[model samples]
Target: LLVLGVPPAFALGTNKFAASCASFTSSLTFIKYRVYDGDLLKYLVFGTLLGAILGVKTVLLLDSSQLRIIIIILMMFVAIYTLFVKNIGNENKFEGVNKKTIAIGFIVSIVLGFYDGFFGPGTGSFYIFLFLTLLNYDFKISAGNGKILNFVSNITSLIMFALHGKILYSIAIPMALAMILGARLGTKLAIKNGARLIRPILISVTLLYAVKMIFDITNH
Candidate 1:
């Protein structure tokens, strides 16, 4: 949006709003189909709420240049690690949710949820990665649980942006509707391709975003 002359703040807020709306809707489907673990989602909400509050303040405090640089550095690391680490999300070895697992989930939920409110470019990707590494969930289940956590963090962040009067309803509402429609197709394809689809998409998007961040830095 900035490339096309949309105000940067408005773009960020609108995108966050639309994505939150879409994520909320898609999360319901995941719950309906039993793709997500209800037990884990409980702690995710708590961690995400606290993290989102901190994140909203962080983004509001930092200048765009500083924020972009931080985001680029973090995303670059994620992209590299994901590419080099092979066969990480291949299997589901979920040893039933325990206090240990929930503890780690809380830490990461705060971190990733902070990321969501601060920028939100790779919220889902990070959630999926964290769940896979932390809980030993396969691509399918990780993606499902990721949606649930992402939705909560997104809503939390959206409320913050809304409170600040940043949301652009004209842009957000339409994008949200389109995103909801696309969610149907996205879920269907996930079912059809399974890990084959999720793994590559995650890696590819992470890398592409990293590259884009580099470009953004250089251009700016």
Candidate 2:
């Protein structure tokens, strides 16, 4: 949608939010109880809600250029870690996450949500990585669940933006359709290839978005 010249609010309002929900629902229906965990899903949903509310406030005051630099640095760190950080989640051994970690996850989700609402870049990939590295969720599950929670945050932000009259409905509808199609394809690819493929894509997208932000900042 951004590549297509649709505005940010419209992009989220129409495309990403709807696509996320559709993909999540479809995945659940297709996979059934094999992978869906209700407790983990609740945490994700809560994170999304918290993030959306924070997003509303953050968009008004955050500096885009500063954010760009920060995200670039963060992505660089993640990329480097991915290269050398063997046993990133080995400490936990796939055990259920602790309460402290869950709390931290909630906080991180809110912070990221605010960033997403304000900047609208690499939000999905960020969530996936956070879950993978911090919470020890496998990359595939993280990506799948990330979509579910991200949809929640996107929808909340969209509603807030729409209520404030920021969304351009004309662009939103078509862009949304495009997003839905894109997300479907993306999700299928993620499912087929599993975590190894998803990790590289996440890094690539984050780096690209980081570079775009840097370019925008420099141009401004």
Best candidate according to lDDT: 1
The root-mean-square deviation over C-alpha atoms between each candidate and the true structure, in angstroms, is: 1.9, 3.4
**Model 1: per-residue Cα lDDT over 35-57, one tens digit each:** 87788778778888888778877
**How well is each residue in 1-220 modelled by candidate 2, as lDDT tens digits?**
5567765555555554554455555455324424333466667567768777777656644544356677888877776675577545222234565687668677777777777677666777777778777778776667766666666777777777767676666755665677666766776777777756776787678777777777766765
List candidate 1 segments past 4 Å from native.
none
User: For every model shown, what is its TM-score relative to the native structure?
Assistant: 0.91, 0.80
TM-score of model 2 (CA atoms): 0.80
- Please list all clashing residue pairs in model 1, or write none if there are none: none
Q: With candidate 1 superimposed using the best TM-score fit, by how many Å does residue 77's alpha carbon deviate from the native?
A: 4.0
Give each model's clash number.
Answer: 0, 0
